[model samples]
Target: MTGGPTLPALPPSLRAPLGLVAVLAALVVSVIGTLYAGHSQPGRVDRWIVSPTADPVGPPWRPVALTLDFLGEPAGSVLLVGVVVAVCLLLRRPRAAVLTVAGVALAVGTTTLLKQLVGRTIHGPDNLSYPSGHTTFFTALGLALALLATDRLGLGRTAGTSLVLCVALLAGAAMGWAEVALGAHYPTDALGGWCTALAVVPATAWLVDRAADRLESAGRPEPR
Candidate 1:
């Protein structure tokens, strides 16, 4: 499994701080999500950003928003992940391919579970909308790619952290905007979803690395 390209090592300098930030941000977002549980109206932050309405954004950008929103849909996500995984395999970065799948799956799954637990709804009673799963999905993908890039390029702490965060922020914001503009989620829901991905991906990456290491160690032949 750890055959080609030496399996880019997760930078020791970048791991701890990123993990800490993710944990703290997730906690804060969760708390805010709790505050608006079972609510139908937009909170102050959500209203300030944009009102909760069907088709909050109009023409010109509407198509663009829909395109982005589709990327979070089942077929879109599968296609997106499949492309990245294929690329990783082509590059002989198996661990990276694994991370991409695991990170995204974990991030999206976390949001789904949180939606049920938080019970924050919008538009309709049965429509759960605490954390924006679309935002979480895109952010997770970006984070996985960022981590792979950082490791492959051997970036230092500052650079790696910056790269990961920048990618995550851009991805999350893009999808979040789409979700909110379409009135599919509240702005705060988007924020929570973004933070959820930020919290989940890094930890998932670390776990992937750890499991790979264990497998490699177990497969190693004893020295004579």
Candidate 2:
């Protein structure tokens, strides 16, 4: 059977144990940062960062706050991920789809689990707030969409990747600012979320690529 359009493959040297190690290091650092900020006493990082924007109820900032809240909702995240996955499937990039789905799932699940384990509470709901779930979902989605654009869309890899990265960074930053400005989460929570995506997406993508390689190799007929 004919295969789908191939994505530009990163060298195995970059995608294997080295890449995995880097991703894991990022996760560890972010986890440590979140714990440090969350568990500190009064006047710690969380308080210092949150105190300034904790009261953003004024008329001027109301619209900005509302817009951010709307964008950060779970519905928005699901929609973004759904669209990306659909596009990847349409482009016959099953590996991309798998990576996207797995990255989002891993980021979201890990954030939720960490929140519960950390048990940190702040200005927002009683639910754990060590890491912002909205930030994690959006960031991961952005990264996945960026990859699809570069890999499947046939855009110049460097230019396309850079453009997408900029946009994604802006969106992620906006979400983080909104959450912090509205007192929904501490700044470190946003940081933790971003770091979580950086770690989870690459690791998930590497694993997906490896599995795909194995499946493809197995399906090939033996040489005469």
Candidate with top TM-score is 1
Worst 10 residues of 1 by lDDT: 1-10
Candidate 2 lDDT, tens digit per residue, 113-140? 8787676677544646767787777787
**Per-candidate RMSD, Å:** 2.1, 4.1
List ranges where model 1 is wrong by over 4 Å: 1-9, 52-55
Query: What lDDT, from 0 to 1, does candidate 1 have?
Result: 0.86
Global lDDT scores for all candidate models: 0.86, 0.68
The digit string of per-residue lDDT tens for model 1 on 16-70 reads: 8798978897897779877997788889987777744444678899999999999
